[model samples]
Target: MPAGGLDIRTFDAVKALAFIGDLSMGQPTDHSLRTAWLAAQIAGAASFRADICDTVREASLLRWSGCTANAAEFTNTFGDDVEGRAAMLAERPDWAELLNAQGGPAQAIAPLAQIHCEVSGEVARILGLGSETEATLRHIFETWDGNGMPNQLNGKAVPAAVFVVALAGDLEIFSRVYGLEHALVLIAHRANFRYPATLTIPVNTHAAQWLDTLAQLAPAALDAALLTPQMQHSTSPDLIADVLDLKLPWMTGYSRAVATTAAACCARLVADPEASERVYRAGLIHGIGRAAVPNAIWDTPTRLSAAQWEKVRLVPYWTSRAGKQMGTLDQATELASYAYERLDGSGYFRAVGGPALGLEARILAASAAWVALRSKRPWRDALSDVAASELLRTEAEQGRFDSDVVEALLEGEPTATQSASPRNIRYAAETTRLSSREIDVLNLISHGASNKEAARALNLSPSTVRTHVERVFRKLECTTRAAATLKASAMGLLR
Candidate 1:
């Protein structure tokens, strides 16, 4: 829905985040979006301002945004946070059930509630929500009179969005678990205190029957949704690279650190403006595919099985898929997809020869490997800087990575400390939007087809195709076919 296609501003942050809540709640996919829509309708009917209703809708969808930030921590504390939330739909906990059960359910449940609330508030703050919005999110679980954890500000002080979102969220859960009739009865009973009397009256009035109204709506209502143009788009080359780190809570800082180190390594190379930007973009989105992989695998400190390794290999592939739907990002996507490839054909998804992998991609591959080796993951503690360097060199010697990029990373750097600050790096690289013809030419170039072959395929004369290829090369800054390939890959030109 963004004017320039699928840049950062194209994807609705609220809608995308609702998917996360759906995952956390163990709901059928897209359940959060539907619940959000239903909640917005309820808010609209309750004399709420249109913008406030929209905010409530947005908050309903994104209220669980921070849950992914600490998934491992949550899983550790509660046997399975994902599974526990799933159970909430059908089962009501009895205090007597706790008294008769083994160990401490009450103690565990309280902290989990507090942790979820606090983390949600933290994510709201990080996303730059307004103060009123932040306050609403913080008190999402508060009872009207007082009892919410992580500090309850009580009734009137709570943001309207929070009150509507909380009630709407629970109503959906209840409706799904029990019949709609039961859900409405429950809301009517809770009306005065737990539910705001004004909002509760309408939800009890229409929502129980209107639950089926969503069926009249199409799927991927989310697909048609738009992010406002006012949101700042991250054009940093590290955009996708840094995004990968956000796949889990504990990894919040990993992608940014790796991107910084990788950019520093690339800085030592020939500074073609286009190539520099391409490499940075590759670093940011390189790990976005990790979203398809479950947090269970990501958080495991133990070794992985063959099945897990296969799942791991698919992350880059998925990252590429995510980019294709976005406009004008082909080069960045391609680089991100192939970031794991090795020169010796040891990587995944069609293991092409070194010629297909391009210089920019090679730099990204090496940089990614170096940063990954240096960072701590579930299976291992971070390697010493010296050890990480040795590992990179070992890979280079085996012809798996570009020696030039590796050398640049190592130049004037015997010790492996942090790379240059990401904040200091200039991201003012000029970007030209690619036209359809240019995109077609670049896609063929990525396949290692010559200009003549591309011309035949596109029904254009060789001269015209050559001109386009030359322009693409100049715009992307590559003298050789390999560099062009890297840029294309970074932009996600390849499928």
Candidate 2:
């Protein structure tokens, strides 16, 4: 995005992401946190360095982080991706037998593994976890044996942290899903294949004790343990937004679009920059709980059953749960979780309406509804601009959405071939982390201005122009001048 970025604590983001992975994989909440706790204990027994222990913990939490990337494929391979995976992780003998079958789960593993590896690796990088953690995640699917997806590195070629994380993850997952005795048997059988035997010994020795200690922790205590403070990542919170969109192909860029539009609407609604900023962020993560639902449910063409609709309603509840685990992010996440709530008290998760809703929350709810109306979904084609506008206003009239907030969303709809909407540009810059002055420079450059030309247009020195241009290129993930121009144009930053 050409807009500004939000700052989130590295652990906070990672913990939220871990929860997403757990949900997608059909595991209990804090499954990853439990795994991390187990892994850290194992690392301590082994006397690994604090940094290596940290790597082990992060890798364990993120092992399944790429589950969403391959969710659609998993749904196609297995009848239900979530339930199928939960069953696959059960401690039966040769439980992954179907995973190796020809044209069965085997055919999908290669591509799915690659997708998972790349996505999890990106998460590791965004959190600024060093090369060790990143490498561990990239090969998280690989086994101690030479058989793995994408890359087939075996033995020492795989990161040492991978084996540790694997052992710990299996301990948490298998024990809960298949009982301790069965889980231990499965872990023992995987000795050299799943992980080296030396690694298995300590786990076998302390497995029960570790699990008992984990079970002893109260819910609040467990949450406190997982939400430990850490250095904040200076990147955009949109990374999680992008990850959420990945679960459904049709949803690509939907979150960012909502974020930009909601911020723009907030600007129209009130003069509070802080309110605008919070609403924009809420827009970005409004669908954070979508990971818990299967793609089959999301991509269903037919009308959903009562059970399915019930699941849909709990989506916001899950998002709220995720927020509760993340320290200090309650406000924005709370606003986001209210995306489906209606002003008429007809929404899911919570039905309170009218006075209970604040201005920023109203903006997010209206923004999400408006954006979803404009975008295509499996059940329906996207509405035309005028049709969507009429429907939004009509819903407001019926008290489903706040009328004033709906008005703000409709204000200044941009023309297709003409200049981008100034309201949009302002929000984009703010949410994308660019300053007003930078937008001015980008505007000049987008219209084919040279460095000196941009400087002249903005009344700045050539050095300053060069600086802003470089920053824009970096922020937009473009290298060449043409690339920057094209990206800026897409972002509505160009004139």
Number of clashing residue pairs in every model? 30, 7
Give the winner by lDDT: 2
Please list the residue runs of candidate 2 whose C-alpha ends up more than 4 Å from where it truly belongs after superposition: 1-5, 91-106, 218-234, 414-495
Which candidate has the top score in TM-score? 2
Off by over 4 Å in 1: 1-32, 88-106, 113-115, 171-194, 197-201, 204-252, 266-275, 288-296, 307-314, 317-337, 341-345, 348-361, 397-399, 402-405, 412-495
- Overall lDDT per candidate, in order of appearance: 0.60, 0.74
lDDT score at residue 416, model 2, on the 0-100 scale = 27
Q: What TM-score does each of the candidates earn?
A: 0.64, 0.81
Lowest summed lDDT across 10 adjacent residues in model 2 is found at 415-424
**TM-score (C-alpha) between model 2 and the true structure:** 0.81
Question: What does the lDDT read for residue 307 in candidate 1?
Answer: 92
Residue-level lDDT of model 2, residues 192-223, one tens digit each, is 98788888777878888989999899866765
